[model samples]
Target: MFDVSEVTVIAVDVFGTTVDWRSGVIDGVAAIAGHHETEFDCPALVDAWRERYLPAVGQINRGERAWANLDAVHREALDECLEVFGVAGKFGAEARERMVRAWYALPPWPDAAAGLAELRRDFVVVALSNGGFAQLTHVVKGAGLGFDAILSAENVGAYKPDRRAYVNAAKLLDAEPRTILMVAAHTWDIHGARDAGFRTTFVERPGEKGPDRPADAAETTDCDLSAVSFADLAGQLRGARKGVDAGH
Candidate 1:
């Protein structure tokens, strides 16, 4: 319960926080595999694909590998997963491309679009993610979520969980870190923003990693606030106003 009243801009992590990426990956893989009339363990494939995300991004974040946007990283992961799953030959180049593009149209979480709209009524809500600009633009638009700005770490050459990414995105908004509230489902992300001098809120996404894979649902952390969902976060932000220049 830090002073949410002072916050004017919200930097949101889009992938798992705003969109159900797990389902998207599963559905995307299933669709392609079915088209080939090939039975595959789509969910397992999705889990494997997602598990590679951290390492892929971590490589760039640590400068161990050359910088590549999320799309390129995802393509790399997809190729590896297909090979490991023994289905690499089943998916040709065109099919692989479509599977990767499917990421751009992930369905928003039930609370996402409306909740973000509510928050926007009182504060600037921006999508700040490790995704590339074009990828984020397509994802946000496809999900029908309205963001005041879409800031990508690719533009800054630094990814999230890296302090530089948060700092650089803050500059683009012409905002001081103190005036911005970083909203994310991942504690690592919150830590990054905190290190960059911003207040943070944890928005819970219990199913983000799917049913069997437990989410990062710590009841409390070092974050300024914790919310059950974006709608809950919006309500908390409104309550913090306390009638000063009250929300409409």
Candidate 2:
């Protein structure tokens, strides 16, 4: 278990952890298909596109590829997805651009905004994501999630599961790795953070991968905490704070 009293800041993962990217991508792809008068399996396209995300980012993390922002990677994946879905050349340049930009406007999960607001009262809350600064900022503002600050892997030119990404976030916040809590929905992200000596929290987000492939809620010994939602996380933190204060 994590000692919440030692934590000074909470670094949140943006994409699948805090926002509903699956819904946003599906909607965006569906709109593009509709506009072009084409029939496509939007859900399959979204899944395929998202499957490319980690490997593309991993190539850069491993120094096998040059540094490129998530937007560029998304566009490359979009091209491949379009071809696979038999919708290539159906969209004009502007339409394709719009489709890639859909990531910038993802809506937050139902409990996200309110839960973060509650947590922010006691701890500094910031975004520590692989997304570009501009894209993260757009999502925060569009969703009205009121983050204390946004720190992207773009700052370190690497992606999560990379040590530099976690270390950079701690350095930027002027805190020790142990004093920063890394909260994410994906176990791989939690594993990375824990390996970097940061406390980890896994927020359960069913259907994060897809409706057919819902994320498992199995409790892992690797994580310090596991919560069903942001609201539940906030409550647990509040209780932990009280325990610390009373002991003090």
Candidate 3:
């Protein structure tokens, strides 16, 4: 395992890593359908919504449009998605808006809340994600997911894989990037965080696919740590520390 105690703060990525976004979005779409006996394609809708995500962020990053949080971008994507699925006017304004707000009600993964609770005991735990501040706050509150602080791409004026996002997180927490371990489920996120000079840990949820080491692999692999779940991650990080740090 990597030396985790060297990290003063553990910044987490939300969405798929901390919460089950797919289930939440599927439920929202079903609610929107409203007993119409419609057989909707949840996977298709989820994929399509995600497909538009980066383009929306790129628009803001390129200065073509002012920066908007992930919540607003999700709304825009939701509207486009509903229209594409032939359900444009099916939902009323209030109902449609609630569906958009579902992002705030994301449920924590089964092990996420408990693992975070444990990990928080030994480290300064925070959310470093692409989620908007309001959205992250709402979701964390709704799920009773405790965090010491929250940072997001919205604050950085850019999205993940952008150096600004990672740097902004470390800066706000007054910690060096190398001393911050970014725990995420996505390899790309881990790669980006590492490129930005932060240590990275990969938490592999069930059904979550990531890197597979090849035979005779080099020691210079990207992720600093990897685990099957947050509980396992807690164990790994805890084991990496030889002595207790007072600040944590």
Candidate 4:
């Protein structure tokens, strides 16, 4: 356990963690192609679109241009993709708009609803994601996720691994770093929170994200719990609560 002092708020990272990006992107592309009267490989397009994600964000962070929301970045990448596949002529402006709207309609992971519902029963649950406010809002509403508050890197004008983003989230919760638990599937995110003095819980959501994570050489090797799913996480939290309740 990081501190075991009775957690008050659980700040969750959206995207590949709480939600399943692989299926979401594929379905979004299928829906867009249907509305646009165009044909594109749903899997290939989903792969291509996500492949551009990191580079696009890095470009913004490098001062190559001002920051744009994930939707704009995704669209820019999609346009380039259409050009690459020699199919730019197939989509109209309206179709393109609808395609972008698809990002706002992600479906929740099967366990997300149940896990979040359980967590909300005990603590103030909020979104702590790299996505912008609009993007996160749409995702939450679309998936019917009941987050008490939505927070983003946009709020800090920076992204993860940056202390400012974590600091901003902590400020919004009006809770000390140690009093809030940061839950995510990515090691970098978990390490970021640990370095920033927050309790961390790592959830494993395999085969639905970009790449496999290498073992962290710098991790404490004793930070906190690593859960294979949200249900597993809930069990750990329940145990932690029991320990707390028992004055252990």
Candidate 5:
């Protein structure tokens, strides 16, 4: 088994890893659209909105655009998505603003709260995400999540996978990159953390993309550990601790 002896802090990716973002976004969009008494496919619109995320973030990563918070990014994408969905004329500034706020109140996955509690029994678990500080705080409060600390991209003035974000987070935690375990449901996130010198864990979240689109797959031989859920991750870490104690 891979060793966990060096892992002192667990940095978890928030959106897809800890919360059901797809469902949350859909519900939020549906609420706004339904309130307008307009009929449209909220799910399809949500998926389109999500597809725009990586490209927008990619622009920041490539230095093609200035730094913007997730709310702003979501707003820009929402506008584009509305045009594409042929509902651009329907949603005004107020309606669009409410839809953007929906991102802050996502519900946690079934294993999230409990698994986080289990991990906290042995390690410092922090919310390390691309979300803004306020957004992350609201999500933690709304979902009743337990995080010893929060390390947001906003804190470092850069988004995830960015060299600045990970570097600053490790500094803030007073932990070496090697001592921090970056756990994420997305392979791209794992690869980013690994490139930044953090050990990585790939947690499968097949439902992240919803029913039609498949979730991201881990790059071959990329992750240090693979788990089906947060509970399984806790169990593996527990086993590692037991094995270490027995060996001594």
Candidate 6:
């Protein structure tokens, strides 16, 4: 129901939307645990660590806690998870810091790299994430993600679904809210951007939260466009652009 021709930029959510955080965190934690001859439920530990993410950011967004970047939030959650899992003493400060940096080394989803390249042909592609500037830069470079620009909630001193994050991204891109497309795997993310007057595109990422946990079916109707992967999204957008061009 929306016009692709109107979209001047595509701002994507980087965490679960573009990169697979669960697998990356699990791999990183398990590697560290293994090296230390420690035993714990790796998946459970990762899940527990991630479960703290939103609340940690929300504390800042709600002004209950002083502003902190995603790296700080992840470290806090990691420390808590280590204690809860009874593996706190297994790693020293250096090893724990390395584990926190695991967020930077996450792999992009299967469709992310190529699909992003395709979409970049017609629109400015950038990252809009809660991760700090350094964190996002590492991920983009490590994964070789070709974003024209990278934006972070750190820039606004807040995390999403805060409206300022989206608004500031639009302002940075010099585009109106309606002229930008917010692409994400999380419905809450899309909902936030849509509420901020930006168009939304929901990309389904199965197992974003955990294995076998696909994106909610209800999310399909909540956005201007829905696709199973970034490839499908690129195809749809390219076709829409073709139609617009032919008419012109």
Best by lDDT: 5
Model 2 Cα displacement at 46 (Å)?
0.7
lDDT of 4 at 176: 93
User: TM-score of every model?
Assistant: 0.95, 0.96, 0.86, 0.86, 0.97, 0.95
How close to the true structure is residue 117 of candidate 1, measured as C-alpha lDDT? 92
Each prediction's whole-model lDDT (CA):
0.88, 0.89, 0.78, 0.78, 0.90, 0.88
Error of 5 at 86 (Å): 0.7
lDDT of 5 by residue, 5-98 (tens): 8889999999999999989989998999999988888999999898888888889878899999999999999999899889999989999999
Off by over 4 Å in 6: 212-214, 218-221, 246-248
> How many times do residue backbones clash in model 6?
0
lDDT of 6 by residue, 80-181 (tens): 999998889899999899889888899999888998998898889999999999999999988879999999997889788988889988888889999999
TM-score computed on alpha carbons, candidate 6: 0.95
Residue pairs in collision within model 6? none
**After superposing candidate 3, which stretches have Cα over 4 Å from the reference?**
35-39, 208-221, 243-248
lDDT of 1 by residue, 129-211 (tens): 98889989999988999999999987699888888998898888888999999999998899889999999999999999888
Better candidate number, 2 or 4, judged by lDDT: 2
- TM-score, cand. 3 vs. native: 0.86
Q: Give the TM-score comparing model 4 with the true structure, all chains together.
A: 0.86
Extract clashing residue pairs from model 3: none
Off by over 4 Å in 4: 35-37, 210-223
For model 1, what is the error of residue 97's alpha carbon versus the real structure, in angstroms, after optimal superposition? 1.0
